[model samples]
Target chain A: MNGSAYGKAEGMKATLIHGTHDIRVSSDVPDPVIRDDTDAIVRVLRSCICGSDLWPYNSADDNPQGDRIGHEFLGVIEEVGSGVRNRTAGQLVAPFVWADNTCDFCAQGLQTSCRHGGGWGSDGTDGGQGEAVRVPFADGTLVPMPGEPDDALLASMLTLSDVFSTGHHAAVSARVRRGDTVAVVGDGAVGLCAVLAAKRLGAERIILLGRHTDRTDLGREFGATDVVAERGDEAVEKVRELTGGDGVDAALECVGYVEAIRTAIEVTKDGRLVGRVGVSQYSDIPLGVGEFMRNVGVHGGVAPARAYIEELLPDVLEGRIQPGRVFDRTIGLDEVPDGYRAMNDREALKVLIKP
Target chain B: MNGSAYGKAEGMKATLIHGTHDIRVSSDVPDPVIRDDTDAIVRVLRSCICGSDLWPYNSADDNPQGDRIGHEFLGVIEEVGSGVRNRTAGQLVAPFVWADNTCDFCAQGLQTSCRHGGGWGSDGTDGGQGEAVRVPFADGTLVPMPGEPDDALLASMLTLSDVFSTGHHAAVSARVRRGDTVAVVGDGAVGLCAVLAAKRLGAERIILLGRHTDRTDLGREFGATDVVAERGDEAVEKVRELTGGDGVDAALECVGYVEAIRTAIEVTKDGRLVGRVGVSQYSDIPLGVGEFMRNVGVHGGVAPARAYIEELLPDVLEGRIQPGRVFDRTIGLDEVPDGYRAMNDREALKVLIKP
Candidate 1:
């Protein structure tokens, strides 16, 4: 594949955020060039719009003209820089949506805190919702599969680039253990993935707090043992009753709302733990000392996506996990705004874009 | 000391709580009898009124009339039941103020949560502020020193019966380490003792948040390296500045008020820990999830007083720790109501009551 591409000059197609709900599809941009010896150019096969991307898309403060978007992607290597030895052209690999796993924070499994880690389009890097993109730390961050995966598997594998890893981190931070009862406090893709992670981590029971029938069905398929349609106190009471009045052993809070976090605490028994994966924009929500003294532990910020991809890829390949089921809809690169609308309107659990 | 014969059958004087703020000093009650084989009756030599006693005294609900009121004491054993093997007649001992120390919870070093560890007065147990009292689980709960302690040492040792151990548990729960900076969130005896505990645990810097000059002086003497006269945000800012823009490594929350707990959280750095030792009468406070996700851990509840008595007795006997410095005044059993008034009015840090 490398020999055939020597004389070809290819331009990339990308989605740019011109303004809130005003994404523009452009194809006149130069293909990403590998600036460093450890970089590789990947021909994006599949990419997906993330929930966080919607923040800038709908925000008045975001660049009104346009900027690059998208983050999650799985692709085939198109070109490799001189120092890129582990991966060859035409091989399939997935890069962690946000980070290069070589910095100090990444080494500590805190890739979300990586010094160079930032959202793709927001920082001038071509967003993953494009035809081609450059991936740094290719040797460390990109996980190559055993062989080319089928289209279905490829779409699911794309989730490992972000959402799946995020959900897994939530479970890990909550210290979910075998035989522990867990409550997932969201029903988005990440929340659905959390159910998979909790099950893989051997949680005895998983109670998903969601209202969508499709999402809840996927949650059950991903090992959610129960679902709580009611929220707040009702949700907490139902969970406690399911666990013999002891509440859950762990709760994964994927929603950033104060009420959701509170529900997580109220739904867990004393000495249990709650892992919060939401990026909180509000700081005034106080953590009551009296409640925490009952032995509740709260941990988690951004997911260390780059750190978990390689560890989770093998399970994905072996069919031991199927996180991609969260992508309830898929569309072409030009349909980005509709994907956002679907998610915003609660019409889709996740939207995958095939470039 | 076991060779001494019983002098006479006589009635013992006790300060009883007839109702809210209605204390009666009487010498009509019979001497405490050892009902269990593992019990021992002790003649109180030194006892003190605690801040917690004020709760029942000031309760809007009718305070149980004719009940004993205090729970901190150091005394000599006057009699032992048949199955008592560790303590005998005439042995100087400090019994745990709350627990038997042998139940499942007690065995797990959570004696305060033991199945039978209810409040002494409410459970029909004689209050420590009396001429004599029966101690359950005498063999496991009371620690006998090598020899008789001097007056000052005995009073300080009496603190180990409750407050001192509680402060130590707060420090332990907060994971105070050598060279770490710590903050004590209250100015009461427990907070003062937390300052001492922080010092003992090798905290390099101790910040006491209080305004009382006497308590501040004693806090400094007890190893508080710094004192913050400011309250709320100002206090948090001062602590952060003292810590070079980072917050303290640990915070000991000794006040149950909403503001005090918030101050403790605000003054602790990301990834640091906070331990709450204050007793909360209500459960409506919100646990701010955003602040907690900065990697703060909160843990602590009722202290297992019995768990620390043995470990602290040696230091007390050697005159190395002076927890008794918290006692600002001493009064006779007849002056019980006055002692309560002094503490309730913040006129005394702690009041030692003599039988």
Candidate 2:
């Protein structure tokens, strides 16, 4: 099948932010072309909008580089450069990032730091919310699916490209030991996934901080033992009350706001940990002298999704876990602009785009 | 011997910082008297200066209430109150701050967060830079020395009160494993002791960042495998170059400044950690997107010295470690003002004061 078989023209339809609050789906966007032997052209199967996508969407600055925007995508390999190894044409792959696995950094499972790596939609590389995308360092970046995934597993597997792995990274970074109590601070898909991760990691209890009833319900399904609807200091007081004033043993700060970070730190007991997967928006998250005296440990940054894929593969493949349900809405490539709008308006928890 | 036998009159000599750059050896300070069962009046044997003490010495404001001024001391118990069960007169002990070890926080080994914990120089509690002091929470806070320490071991044992244990906290917090490569920032006594801690924890290699020949030599004696005598960016580049661009497995941020913290982060490999023991002086330590992308984990805060004393006691008792060597100068209690001056002037690595 050619690109036209998937509703593509001589060009690709991709999402681009024109300016503040402006998103457009245009077919004039050029199709990804392979420039390196280690690159692969993937025919995108599914993609989704991320919370971080909102930052640029709300920024006052207009898009200057006409950058290709989406990052979360899993696709079938349509073409592999001659130098590509460990992957072949027609295989399904979702890379952690566009990283070469051969670099010293990548060998230790930090693909995000790959020497030759470049993220989606940078330096002419197309984004994932398109008909097809070009992925660099394909051999090191792309992890092949264990088997041909059915639609039941497709969305969950696609999450391996970012969100699910990121949630898992929070759990791992917090050192979520078996039988420990965990509190997750955020209501988005990642925070909900963290609730699931804490359950999968054998946490004895999971407390989720969220106000939205719909997302909180999802939190319960994802193994949240309780949900604290209050926020900031009230939320912290509620968690402390629930934990019998000792605070939870571990906390996951999935919201980028400094207030969320502070609540996460406050709700954790002394000598406990707070894992932060959300991109920090503050230059300095105030670590209060009182909290510092408690000896709270803060760890986690970007998820090296490449490192976590293999660890989570069996769970997803064996039908023990289904992270796909995070997508409350799905739309075609032509409807991406609407998808972004629905997400921005909170009418949809997460939007999946099929291209 | 009575309290008066040790040259104690109705008043005893004490070091008081009246204001910035104003330290006095006053003989009018009242002698400590036990007022509670958990309280013990200790005739101080030895005390030492700390880097944290320098913070207010250069500040503009004078200390209100004239808080007794010091926190580190090793002393002989001259008297114990009725409620004290684990302590008695004549026992030599070093209490971590003035923490009541029976509190919920202290029971968990974080004396720094003890519910009833208070530092010296308060209402009636005196500073350690004196002939005698009243210590609260005799049972829980005081850790008795193994025996009457010889002069060769006294200063090292005195260090267990603060700096050595702080360095140990840095190493333990970093989770220093066998065969890992470690780097330590700052050449202060704490940094030198961190090199010792890393060695004691079985790190394969230790790197020290310092430009001081004398301190770097001490660092080498304390187990530094290599010394990168550069500052800021040059030091970071040098460590990376030496590590073959892979960066060290772990780093210790022993300097309180942002520049040192930045250097520690920059010299660490992706997914590695930097354990900080310095009293953070910056409101915000900027973590750039590059380091965040690499997944650099910064873990650590104040040293829970009370919690670590027992764990490190065996090493000190068996003569397996010589942490005392960090003290490069010794003086009588009357010379404490000079001791602080020498330390503030960078003329001494660390100062030990005998009462």
Error of 2 at B309 (Å): 2.4
- DockQ, candidate no. 1: 0.23
Candidate by candidate, in order, the iRMS in Å equals: 4.5, 2.2
How far off is residue B292 in model 1, in Å? 6.1
Give the chain B TM-score achieved by candidate 1: 0.93
Model 2: how far residue B248 lies from native, Å: 3.2
Docking class for model 2 is acceptable
Query: Candidate 1 lDDT, tens digit per residue, A133-158?
Result: 87775776678876778877887788
Off by over 4 Å in 1: A1-46, A51-63, A66-162, A177-179, A199-230, A279-297, A306-320, B1-45, B54-68, B74-108, B132-147, B220-223, B280-293, B307-325, B344-347
Question: Per-residue lDDT for B1-355 in model 1, tens only?
Answer: 2312333358788988777777777787667777677778889999998877887778735555477767888888888878888688888887665566776557757666556665555555788888988787688767886676677887888899888988998898788999889999988999999999989989999999999988889999999989999998899899999988768889998877767777887888665567878775545433454453455556666677778888877777787889988998999998888999889989999999777
Candidate 2 lDDT over residue span B1-355, tens digit each: 2333333457988888878877777888877776666788888998988888887676737765354577788889988877889888898788658787778778877788777887677656788888888787888778988688898687778888899999998898788889989999999999998999999999989999998999999899889999998898899899999899879999998988888888998898888888888888775555545655677767777888888888888888788999999888999978887888899999998898888
DockQ: which candidate is best? 2
